[model samples]
Target: MGSVNAISKPTPVNPRLSSLPGESFPVCIIGLGLIGGSLMRDLAAAGWPVFGWNRSAHTVKVANRSGFDVSGDLDATLRRAEAEKALVVLGVPMPALPRMLEAIAQHAPSVGFTDVTSVKAEVHELVEQHGLTDRFVGGHPMAGTANSGWDATMSGLFDGAVWVITYDNAKNRGQRGARLWLDTWRRTVQMAEAVGAAVVPTVARRHDSAVARISHLPHVLAEALAVTGDMGGPLSLTLAATSFRDGTRVAGTEPELVRAMCENNREALVKALDEALALLQKAREDIASPGQDLHRLATEGHAARMRFEARAGRKVKDAPRRPIIRVQPGAPGWTDQLSSAESMGAQIGIF
Candidate 1:
């Protein structure tokens, strides 16, 4: 924390990245919002030179006050990244990514590009449109709260959390920078692990669908729950219990952030919501049936929820942390062994 400029080529935190000699290459985070600012702080703490760019002057002031080397000039930052082949992490909103992707593609094509957005397939489209699929790996660090901005960020937030990294070697190996792709993967995992996240390799579409059910749907439901009850009622606040308070916790997240996520990936979210609705309907019917023996839905729901909670706490012992699912543009049946429909191919062995 003394001097950001005094950093060195970071040591590899994991054996898989042992051969990646220290280039002392810095990482440039394009946004200084909660995720981006936290990443910069953690990377700098790990002895990697870190630079950041943010649009808001107040945000820049806050970052500089926090001792981060944030620049208001994005063009200069991108040029610096070009010179060092520094990895770029885009932590901006989903809609802002395409323009930034195009810029990174044109100005910093040599460096590896990744993101912290929950949605993937949309960005995958932007990556392909800009011919950046090879140089960019889609990512989502499952570490966040109902907060935003630098002050809201916690440096150790990602600790013990799941960070999903997308992998693909579908590109022809003959491409000029094909080998660098592997280096990018190593550096990405290395940096992610440095921040205390347990890396999980997954496909983009698979990640989107799983997050839709596990993450996105929860936000929508929480917002609805928070708004459904009468605020005017005198007993409304007094009647709330731990369940009510905990269930609507995510409703406190910034409206824009919630809106962006729900709007961007609504297709997948709608499907998950539909399933949730059907299950609720079944439970409703079962509750209406006075027969104690016909409460099958309730029993199934309890067991299902318990099974999820069980796996959520268990870490894979022999599971390979490297690329678990490979995604190629037209690779036939790639999903056959890797679909979330089949437990998200979590059992697929890493080669």
Candidate 2:
């Protein structure tokens, strides 16, 4: 990565390239799994001529059979994207990101890029190594079901969802922070917001660290709890109801995905796990006491959950809160001359 001495409009360094708007530039989705298929569906429905490619011939056949424009040839897909000045969104699993990056680097080195992959830091690093950050912005739509593949995909899945964008806003950084100066990056943000997703910006490492604690850790804990409860006997499964089912439902998600997430985010997840164990230990100690301590913990947890729900709604107070003052009849500032109700009302033009 190189830095510019001064701020400048981004150039392709290859003069023929234009910074086209996302709508004018076609979108070539390199994978048609859950997130990719949903993106393809929504964009095509919105009137953008979308193109798709996939690793599986069966998946390609399924998409083409369903009346989508697609091709299995990686080279052809890259050529069309280059001709159209398209943005390519990689929607494969975390494990597949590297191979796709390698292919894209070889075939379409100049095309703009983003991904719907959950992990960020590693992908950002890979993009830098390929020198593709000039045309790449790392993105993760913080939306999904615990489901996988094309059949599980649906439109409007990103509505009202927070789309985490990993890019530095700072200057002085070149390839790694090209997102700051690139017209293509702005268009990508617009494209994401156009899909009814709110874009939240942060650096790649920060995105990964936050996701590990919030997203990956929960999946880990859910699977752990499900297994722990079942250790008692087969009867435990029969006894499981709403609470048990809802709490551990993610435990049934594709094991390969869970394993990949855990492995990729091990460091931050381990830290989150340590914090969770400390809290669990505190809960255990409080449960032994069973009256004040446990009650207080539960009360605090309930309050936090309520606060979370409240904050998730629209119209949260984004500005700093201010203090309010009330003046009464007997207060120090009160003067009998103006304190008369009629006199004050007349002065203030109020009744």
> Which candidate should be chosen as best, given TM-score against the real structure?
1
Q: Which stretches of candidate 2 lie over 4 Å from their true place?
A: 1-24, 173-181, 234-239, 289-292, 313-351
**Candidate 2 least-lDDT 10 residues:** 342-351
List TM-score per model, in order.
0.81, 0.76
Candidate 1 per-residue C-alpha lDDT over 243-335 given as tens digits, one digit per residue, 9 for 90 to 100: 889989898888888888888898899999999999877777777778734467767878989978755743333334323443332345543
* C-alpha lDDT of all candidate models, in order: 0.73, 0.67
**Per-candidate clash tally:** 0, 0
